[model samples]
Structures are given as structure tokens and as C-alpha cells.
Target: MLATIERVLILDRAEEISKMVLQSEIAEEYFRCIYKVKNNLETQRKIREFIKVKEQYEEVQRFGKYHPDYRVVMIKVRELKREMDLDEHVAKFRIAENELQSLLDEISVIIGHSVSEQIKVPTGNPFFDSSSNCGGGCGSGGSCGCSA
Candidate 1:
């Protein structure tokens, strides 16, 4: 019962901190960019067109060598993809989204590190370590089996 109450208090505090973070300048900018892109009719139309073309191309591919229009569909798909990538609004939105995602990823990593520390879990660059014998079975010439 006490543990449950403590957990609820911690969660409440965490939610409060999250609300504060969302009101910060960086979060505000992220939301602004996201809303701007979402509200753009032209951008939305282009995105829909691109998705339709991509789906058509995928369907053709799924038919394998049996589909006669596979080559033409692939060409159309590539063209549509290129045009979509060239769109200014779409490009800007992608950049903004990437930035926001990176920020979120960094925050998640920080929180993960904090939790790991409290739990006494080993945390650091999991990629390469000369001291630790827990060679991640990465099969890249190292004891870890992880492939390069």
C-alpha cells in the first residue's frame, strides 16, 4: 500500500515536470513547426499523393516477377519520391521533426541513465569496452557477437 502511494506521488511529480518541460522554448518551437506542417493543405496533398504512389509500387513488388508493370511502377515511385523530397515545406517539416525527435531521444537517454544508476546497473558505451568481459556476442572479430 505504501509503495503504491509512493509510486503515485513520483508519477505525479514526473507529470508536473513534463508539463513544465513542454512549456519551455524548445518544446514550444517544436510544436509550432509541427502544427505549421500539419495545417498546410498543399503539403498534406503532396504527402498523400506520395503515399499512394509508394503503396502502388509496393503492391507491384509484392507480385514479384509475375507483374508486368513492375518496372514502370518502380520508375513512377522513384519519381514521386524525388519530387516529394524536393518539396520545401515537406523538407522543412522533416528537419523540424528530426530535431524534435533528437531532443526527445536525448531526454530519454538521460532518464534511462538516471534510472540505471539508481538500480546499480552497469551503464556506459555498450559498444566497446576493453575492461568489461561481457563481450556482447557481436560477431565482429570481438568476443561480443554483435556484427559490425
Candidate 2:
């Protein structure tokens, strides 16, 4: 009971700190601004950076989820030496491993979907105005608009 309360307090403090950092006016405005890219390569570069950071954070969460599983697996392996039914222990261990594998696959799919969505740029969006054909001279920066 005491441990649970302590954990709850810690998490509450952490969330408060996160809200302060993320909800600042400057941070909100900066993230709201549309990013301008000179070319497809530049756009891709920016997208990659965003994806990398997201993936890193997800990886940390994945590691955290597995910590308890690691302990369970260790216990099961040690129990394999006991006089209990060997088949039952083996089956249980396999089940745990399968569960872990499934979790990893789900995480991969979520990250892939998130990254793909971020990279999908709508045509004619002002963020990439140069790349969109709006009856301009030469595409901006030799991209698609020639209005430079």
C-alpha cells in the first residue's frame, strides 16, 4: 500500500513536469508553425529527424514493458529444475516468449504507421509551395516552381 502511494506520487510529479515543458507558449507556437523545405531531400531530412526521436521514445517504453517479463522468465527458468511437470513449465515459458514477440511486432507496426503518416505531405500545401504547380515560372529552387 505504501509503495503504491509512493509510485503514484512520483508519477504525478513527473506528469506535472511534462505538462510544464510541453505546454509553454513558445513550445506550442514553435510546433504549430509549418516547416518550410527547399526540396524533397530537405523535407525528408526533417521528417527523418522527427521519426528518429519518436522511435527512440517508443523504444524506451518497450524496454520498460519488458522489465517485468525479464524477471518472470528468470523465475520460470529456475523453476525448470524443480520436481514439477517439465512439460507444463516448458509450455509456460514458450507462451511468455510468444507474448513478448507479439508485443514487439505490435510496437513495430505502430511506429511504422506513425512515421508514414508524418511523411505524407498533401499536394499544393503552402509548406511545399515551390513543389506545387500553381502556374508559376520556374519551380522555386529548381524544384517545381520557376517564380524565383
Q: Write the per-residue lDDT of candidate 1 for residues 8-84, one digit (tens) a residue.
A: 99799889878876887667877776786678887777778889988888898889768998888888888878887
TM-score of each: 0.69, 0.22
Q: What is the lDDT of residue 140 in candidate 2?
A: 60
Model 1, residue pairs in steric clash:
136-144, 136-145, 137-144, 137-145, 137-146, 138-144, 138-145, 138-146, 139-145, 139-146
Per-residue lDDT over 125-148 for candidate 2, one digit per residue giving the tens place of the 0 to 100 score: 243323334332343675643323
Worst 10 residues of 1 by lDDT: 119-128
lDDT winner among the candidates? 1
Q: For each candidate, what is the lDDT? A: 0.67, 0.45
Model 2 scores what on Cα lDDT? 0.45
